[model samples]
Target: MPADPAVVDTDCCIVGGGPAGMMAGLLLARAGVRVVVLEKHGDFLRDFRGDTVHPSTMQAMADLGLLDDFLKLPHTEVRALSGQVGDEVVHLADFNGLKTAAPFIALMPQWDFLDFLADAARRYPTFDLRMNARAEGVIERDGRVAGVRAATPDGQMEVRARLVIAADGRRSLLRDAAGLPVEDLGAPIDVLWMRLSRRPADDPEAPLGRASAGRMFVTIPREGYYQCGYVAAKGGFEVIKAAGIEAFRRDVAQAAPMLADRVGELASFDDVHLLTVAVDRLTRWSKPGLLCIGDAAHAMSPVGGVGINLAVQDAVAAANILHDAFALDDAALDERALAVQRRRLPPTKAMQSLQVLIQNRLIGAALSGRPLKAPAVMKLFERFPRLRRIPARVLGLGFRLERVTSPDAFSG
Candidate 1:
């Protein structure tokens, strides 16, 4: 017979060490709460994850007084956003006018961001991060979730906590284990991501997006390479693959001529990674002893690269609400979990709605080969520079900006 799994206990057990899980763990740990964060992966080196850290998230860092240190990490800042529609280059949004400590969107690798948060969290004596531990399911007791069952290389281990948080990505195993229902908002585009060398003579634009003919392409300038994304119809990757690598390169070149020379870099389909876009949210975000946050609660479409920011916001809200709830009994603890969903659901819905609108009207139409031009809205933004701040505020900040309300127990 197999040996029984080891058991550990904590105040809060967070599954998935992404932006949400790590941020929540850090914040709650700062409040003197015992937090055990479980990351399935041994390392945070996953590529092509959402890297846009907007001003709102930075503001939360400022609230925690970690902004100066966090900014020291290697990252690029984008002050404005624009897209090419047919023959005209339409300036979509500008972040320069936003009234915040960090107005621009900071583009850093997701792994670096997670590592920074983990490092900060580790400073708290109550924070315990266990990597290479994948959560398999929730541990139920007395008709309520009381902990997590995770698989580690050593063997199986159970973490019993006052409350359990599921921050696993869109395909969350714990959310399913909790029997939470999801409302599929649907997505119409999938993105193929690749990198191409950025030469000194290349365009210096921070991020460049293009939609015309029958394709859509975007390139975010990185330190030494351009992170490129090619958008296609939903479930259309097979068709793209069947067309062969040369045809794929031709399509990429046609979509964004700036990368025409680098198109050859994508020698085969293996060189490109496909992100199966999904827009969805859990109809009910919490059950008795468990709460769902980030992609686990709502999977976002990569429209504005807002997934990371949204997930971070969810963590902030969760920490703000639930930091002290551990002192309460089981019933009050359940209410605190529901409170996180209540406070975060509005912004989540608003962002998802905006994503769906763009996916349907813009991405879907472009993929259908509809003749494209700068939309009237884009034209207006270009015509009147001040109008750009509207999108800047919405995208660069967010609908409901969360503040770091969890008290620092270690602060003198």
Candidate 2:
């Protein structure tokens, strides 16, 4: 039988319907560019991922006019942040003097935030969302990306577009097809995530806390249940589970005595899930008509909790350049459009590198009970109240007063 004709053609074809892809499609579609988004998963949001939206990300949502909706969702307002240094809790409130509208971090499940973005994208007439379509490979013609080849249930098909975006995530098939280089900075620890029912009389103390020890526990407030995450060294899952449910409960109790009473409430091991934290940085973000955004470009370690926020920033930057690129009268398929990719790649790379350094080298050791300090770390909190603001900005909470061109521009 003859092959079916191209199902649909669009100006921009975005692979992956996660935050980065959806945000890019929303902006492009709103700008009147015909966009088609392909998502491998039927549903977008997955459980037990980064749920905290930094102050800067909230500001980004505000710019997109979704701030009110985002704020109205079931989330915990982290009035004060805290960290651990060998069983000692250091309140982050001291750094709250930094200049930002939402000085406090908001903890919401990542699934809800993604759902909101997808719903907003549906409002645009030019947006075409296709779920259960997995991108298998890229189609290249004359040393440039032509479009993509995706697999459907019945058969394989081709999608032709002027521009193709690989927001398919860290294990991006499109990135692999393009033969892009990926550097995986191994993670020193892994996280075991679980949800627990909050006691009716549980103390309502901001819904967020961390305990310092060989193991770390973070409790975040959800609508009805509390999202709890426990951190342990790599390859510790079997050891932890072998200790049995009672011993595991005791471990949590030792970490956060307040949550000890609630530990016994856990019904089964099925309630908990484990995730390995791996940091990755792409050697190149683009080639001709193809561009990689979000986790596809740079996957940061979960320590700073900046992955989603950085992905949002990349979407905005790409949209800005794409809008300009498509507006040109001679905007035919060529190397000229690659400029957008070039402009955004550097900052993403720099941020990812810094994340690896902080998560694996400095902060990782501290979180793991090692006693080593750099003078700069002490001065960051003591001498400069402004330095704390840098992270807020990096996480997409607010903008710096200076016209910063690079990530290093704000470093002290």
Q: Rate the local accuracy (lDDT) of all candidates.
A: 0.92, 0.70
Judged by whole-model lDDT over C-alpha atoms, candidate 2 comes out at: 0.70
Model number with the top TM-score:
1
| Residues 143-212, model 2: lDDT tens digits | 8787888877767778888789999888888888888888777777778888766664655545444545
RMSD of each: 0.9, 5.7
lDDT of 1 by residue, 225-272 (tens): 999999988898999999899999899889888778888988798899
Where does model 2 exceed 4 Å of error?
1-6, 93-103, 153-155, 207-211, 327-342, 361-391, 394-412
Q: Quick one: RMSD of model 1?
A: 0.9
The TM-scores, one per candidate, come to 0.99, 0.83
How much does candidate 2 score in TM-score?
A: 0.83
